[model samples]
Target: MTAASRGILRVVDSDAAEAERNADARSESQSAKDTAQLVELSKSGDREAFDRLVRVTHRDAYALALRLTGNAEDARDVVQDAYLRAYKGIDRFRGDAQFSTWLYRIVANCSNTHLSRRQRQRHDTLSIHTELIDTRPEHDPALQGDRAELRVRLDEAIRKLPERLRSVVVLRDVYDLPHEAIAAELGISVTAAKVRLHRARRRLREQVLPMPGEVPRP
Candidate 1:
């Protein structure tokens, strides 16, 4: 193609991309408005509105639950519990934060509880003294594990984090919530959220890629 034609094509592509972005922004704005209205109606005891709100938000909620719980079964259970609790407490929601934010907090809390209960059950079933499994990869100059294996290791490390640290790290890193928002959701100070995230990341690095003489956690 001639230089002028190529330039024209590039301009067209740029305009199309910009228009797509604007459309996405408008769609997100409309979704937020719709969600707010649904929250108000649900708070007023409208069951159908609450069901509509669930349909709108369930996919994202399940994604968050899966990230937090690290398994599909546990994630589904956490989501169910979270929504039930939210329904029971909707009258107390008070609109202090976005409905999605509030729902995410409930999901996180439910995941923590579910995982804790599962851990206790495992402990009861297993021997009194549990053995830690060290999952160090092959001794390559570069840790040559594939991306999927690395992700599994990371998920395992996140799962082993204490509830407080796990919640903060997942909110900040996985969900990309700001420290301020995380603190608001968790009802903690921003400083506490930052501290927990730093500690969680440090622990994760230790577990996922231990230095010489350091023990990797299970």
Candidate 2:
């Protein structure tokens, strides 16, 4: 290209980059402001403010509930009940943890309560088809098929795990809770939480790994 053309192109690219940077910065600033505003409003007992928080967190909570309950209807019920309990107990929130973490404790408890009730009624084994409906589909066909298969195996593996180990694994891996938060939520020491997580991971790995010569490594 000619010198003038090159100079114009450079200016255009610079302007585009600057615009993108400005947009990202503005988005970050707005997000921080919104978070702060919500926390302040929630502290003031604004139901709408708390509702906004729920809207943001509900997807994660629902996913965790689904993984634990292994049924869409039950997971939905758990999430709804958890939200209701959280709303009723919002005044007890001390802000020691992120609001999301506190909300997760409620979701976990709700899921546990639902599971215990189901166990008492002797209706705990979920079908693979039923479990599939509770999970989000993967975009790739091969990956989706693999995930579906894994889900079946994982469901069985999770069910077989000891309750304490299962709870830690679900909170840490499925719900993405940090070790400290998991311990705090479960009322266990952090070392105990880590040990449970370790045992759970080892057991899951052994359950999922293929037999010798059955699968190839990259």
Candidate 3:
């Protein structure tokens, strides 16, 4: 290829890339405008518009719930709960953000509540087991107490995590979701998801694990 031909080809490639980016930006802007219009209609008692918005955003919302809950059943329940809450609180959704962003945050918060309730149920079961151990002559009360305390600490650590980090940890460690799936569900790049998981695990270990040469609490 001649130098002049190569220079011309490079200019053409740059123009094409710039045009594609401009197109994407315009598309996103249009989508946001359409969503805002729907939000306005729904707030004014337009059920069909709201339903249309639901159809457009449901897949991403469900994906968010599934990653957090780690169960299809619970994900479905969370999504339902989220939509109901969104419907009732539609008036509270000021146009400060995109409708989808507001909606996804609702899903995340609902999933957090659901997970908390499930955790509490497990804690209650452990309490029952501890009570049973009190009556069993052969059971080691001290060992059981230690186990229960450790679990409580671990749960507290997980609960204390920021929502973004907590979601990654639950999806990656608890649910065994792949990095790509986690990324898709959380609307992040795979690298960002993996980084969040790393940070989350480190925070958890710092809270849950005993330091070297330090004795664990009894």
RMSD, each candidate, Å?
Answer: 4.8, 7.3, 14.2
In terms of lDDT, the best-performing candidate is 1
Model 3, 26-69: lDDT tens digits are 99999888888899999999999999899888998897687566
How well is each residue in 1-218 modelled by candidate 1, as lDDT tens digits?
99999999999999999999999999999999999999999989999999999999999999899877667998999999999999999999988778888888888778878877897886433221113536445433126588888887787667666667778888888877778877776678999989999998887887777665565553
Candidate 1 regions off by >4 Å?
124-165, 178-193, 202-218
- TM-score of every model? 0.72, 0.63, 0.58
Weakest ten-residue segment in model 1 by summed lDDT: 124-133
User: Candidate 1: what lDDT?
Assistant: 0.81
Q: Tens-digit lDDT track for model 2 on 4-52?
A: 9999999999999999999999997777578567767887899899889
Model 3 has an lDDT value of 0.74
lDDT of each: 0.81, 0.75, 0.74
Pairs that collide in candidate 3 are: none
- Candidate 1 similarity to native, TM-score: 0.72
Rank the models by lDDT, top first.
1, 2, 3
**Once superposed on the true structure, which residue ranges of model 2 sit more than 4 Å away at CA?**
1-32, 126-164, 178-195, 211-218
In model 2, state the lDDT of residue 12.
100
